[model samples]
Target: MHINPYGEDPVRFAVELAVDPPSSAADLVARCRAAGVTDVTGREVDLDDVRRFLDEWLGVVDAPDEAARADRLNALLAAASAYPRLTNHAGDGWHLHYRDPDLPLAGVLRALISVGTALHLAGRGMHRLGRCAVAECRRPFADVSRTGRQRYCSPACANRDAVRRHRARVS
Candidate 1:
């Protein structure tokens, strides 16, 4: 079965890109492929534009409250607005795409990231996306945990914080 592309994957990808942005167009394309994005072609990619778009997206992640987050995300959604359409590009089977056909890799990523983030937040919870609880490593992360109480970006960060707390108690 064809999985929905505009779902958890894109949101997770956004987090990955935000944490360590691609250094070049080739790097971006390679990372996209690594993240299961098969549609990217060797078209001229503008890394600056993608970085700018990602900065805007990070605003939603860093918003002070739910309302602010929604507002920021709504702006991005509006910017990437396109009527949903079905296609079987690359013989991947029919799937819904919320973007215009033949768009550049940057355009496609903007739409996917925006729509995917919306779906993730609406389907999961507004508080699902956040920064790591570790003060030294405030990296962004998409909390896909079943219990939805994830505070750190990774198990290591969580364990590090816990160990610090334990040491403090002992001292």
Candidate 2:
């Protein structure tokens, strides 16, 4: 199956930022670059913009139901999306972009994350985005597993919960 390129990675990137926000503008830009973001010029407002966007995205993740999630995401999609365009920079294969050209780092992130998240939720299940089930660890997690049954943020959390249950049962 041809998985959508814009789906998984962008949601993962959003989760990473929401988990541990960048300490500085440089750190944010560096993280973006590490995530294969292109055309980042390191503008000062990028940090604030990205933080604001992440906050809004968290609202989507924390939505009470699928309809609410779709509402929040639709708002983001309306705010962030632009006309689609095709580009082939650096001789790479041409790809469609849903953002305008010459946008700043934050703008790029907003477009990518919003559109990618929409595609993910629409293609996958609407309940795919969620927080960890562990009581002490409410970290956000994107359900990327093939079966779409991810409840914890990581295997460690699942194991921890299992051990806790085992201990409770033994006692």
Candidate 3:
């Protein structure tokens, strides 16, 4: 079966990029490729735009409450973006692409990330994406868990958190 390309990877890409944004278009593409971003568009100038866009995205994440979340996300959608379209890159059958052609890297990312995030958070659960529970690990994680109680980022973090709690109780 053809797994959805816009699944875990794109959401993870957003977290990775948001956590530590790349400095160049090549860097963006390279990092994305490393993170499992298959199909892509844009180059150097596009990368610069992507960096700027990420800064704005971070602000949304930092927003205080649900009202602010909607405001920030809506602001992001209203600014220099577009609706979803159909594409069939490499004749791989049609799928919805939420971007225009040849957009600079930032524009492409804004759509990909926004749409990918929407799909991920909605499909998975609103609480899916979040910071790891381990104190020192500030990494973001997209919870692909079958159960919705995923508070920590990974098994390591979950174990570490449980251990910390146990140690504190014993002490």
Candidate 4:
């Protein structure tokens, strides 16, 4: 069965990109492919454009409250101008696309990330996306945990914080 592309994967990819953006168009294309986005069509990608888009996306992550976050995301969705359509572009099987045909890489990413983030937030919880609670590494993350209590970006950060707390308690 074809998994919905407009789901956790794209949100996770957005977090990954925001945390450590690609350095070049080739790197972006490769990373997209690695993230299972095979339809890398349309105009040649501009690295600067992609970076700028990602910065705008981070606004959604860093918004102060649910309303603010929704407002930021709505702006992105409006900018995407995406409409749902069925496509089997790679002959994989029929699936849904939320973008026009042959949009540039940046446009495609904008639609994918915006729509995916909306789906994730609405499906999971509005608080599902945020920066890591660890003070030193405030990286963006999409909380895919079953319990929905992910605070740190990775286990290492969580463990480090836990150990620090333990030492403070001992002291």
Specify the highest-lDDT model's number: 1
TM-score, candidate 1, is 0.97
* Per-residue C-alpha lDDT of model 3 across residues 100-144, encoded as one tens digit per residue: 767665666787777666667667766666667686985767677
* Rank order (by lDDT, best first): 1, 4, 2, 3
lDDT of each: 0.92, 0.88, 0.69, 0.90
Off by over 4 Å in 2: 1-5, 42-45
Off by over 4 Å in 4: 41-43
Clashing pairs in 1: none
- Residue lDDT tens for model 4, 14-52: 989988899888899999999998988546798887888
**Candidate 1 per-residue C-alpha lDDT over 8-86 given as tens digits, one digit per residue, 9 for 90 to 100:** 9999999999999999999999999999888887556889989999999999999999999999999999988599998
**RMSD for each of the candidates:** 0.9, 2.1, 2.8, 1.1
Reference-based lDDT, residue 106, model 2: 82
Off by over 4 Å in 1: none
**Candidate 2 lDDT, 89-129, residue by residue in tens:** 53567788888877787888899999999999998999999
Per-candidate count of clashing residue pairs (backbone under 3 Å): 0, 0, 2, 0
Scored against the true structure, residue 153 in model 2 reaches a CA lDDT of 97
Provide TM-scores for the models: 0.97, 0.93, 0.79, 0.96
